[model samples]
Target: MTAPLSEQQLAEIAAREAAASKGPWLEGARRGNVPTLYRPLTSGDGVSTYPSVLFELTSVYGGPGDMAFIAAAREDVPALLAEVERLAARVTELEAEHPSRFAATPAEVDVYLRSILAEDTYLRYQQAIGSEAVREAMDDATAYRNCDDNASKKQAWRSGIDDALGYVDPDGDVGPYPSNLLCSQHNGFGPCPGYPWCTPSQDDTEPGDPS
Candidate 1:
């Protein structure tokens, strides 16, 4: 009687089969037509378009002092996308080898999965870096939205906040208090707890006030 193939022999067979099955898809992916087994980015808005994540990363206020950091991130985007594509190609190669006559060993799948994850993480890092400038621009554009001169804008902002607060606290009336102001008399530090701002007035010193 013929002996069954050993695990090592089985692994070899699986690898060969996977390689053959994945060749067509791999070729297509090289031309940017990666099959269903490979999807690099869900949104095909093009590389030039700003991703939401990139927008968020650069959205923080840093003034002219942050120019260097933003520039550095923008430089990293291409590098990140390249790495993402590289890993995606590898994943497709591995996945195409699926459903072979021989059972695919767990170790083979694990290595492929790890490669995909590493590339994806690198891509995200690059995108965040790329979006820094766009985010900064967005922040700068809206910088004047809170100025005292822009009373209409400020009122709109306050009204929105109040509406949100009311929605959350339907039983109570919520208004913009001193604690919510941008500058305070306390050296512009923040709202003082001693002030009757967001907190209710304390009449503890009044004798028999609550008895």
Candidate 2:
């Protein structure tokens, strides 16, 4: 497959489009079976005429499809370019807000997985507590949901849940623990509380250790 167009290539295309004559251009009266492009002109009296020829298909190889596309591109290119730029900007904004969504590398994937686990754990804790104060605090802390600091707030919330649930940090790090250990520690029981699939037999490893 061909590589995607870069911002520079897009900008170059935009520049060419801008430099081209303004459109609402049309295929003018054919000259000896050859197609010609004409910019519709409006006189001071408001009469429209196709006297101004913008381009002509002089080559014998050109067809009606080529003429049609070239005529339409005067306006279509700019509109398509605009949509491309808007989508690119939105993707950039999303990447900035939640970079893990676009993670590619193994380490990045691990971080993304950890973040998902942390968020799930944090949400479960909040739901179990069912306290208005805690909910309000979470909302306040993450009010600027698109901001970079929101990530830190999420980490803080996860840490708080870890402390409240008495999670043992086997790795000596304040990040995601193994799912089996998390489930076991969550309810002070061997079986996972919310997750029906997780059982002691399925994960034979001890609470603080992961195989």
**How does candidate 2 fare on TM-score?**
0.29
Q: What does candidate 1's lDDT look like per residue over 1-211, in tens digits?
A: 1333456755644454443322112111222331222212223655433444322122123323233333444534554456567767777888786656356443344334435644334334323433553455445446546465677766765565555443332324221222221113333333233332221233242322343
Pairs with steric clashes in candidate 1: 18-97, 73-129
Q: Any idea what lDDT model 2 has?
A: 0.51
* Candidate 1 regions with alpha-carbon error over 4 angstroms: 1-65, 99-211
Candidate 2 deviant stretches above 4 angstroms: 6-12, 43-124, 127-129, 133-211
Q: Which candidate number has the best TM-score?
A: 2
lDDT of each: 0.39, 0.51
lDDT of 1 at 13: 42
C-alpha lDDT (0 to 100) for residue 199 of candidate 1: 19
Error of 2 at 10 (Å): 4.3
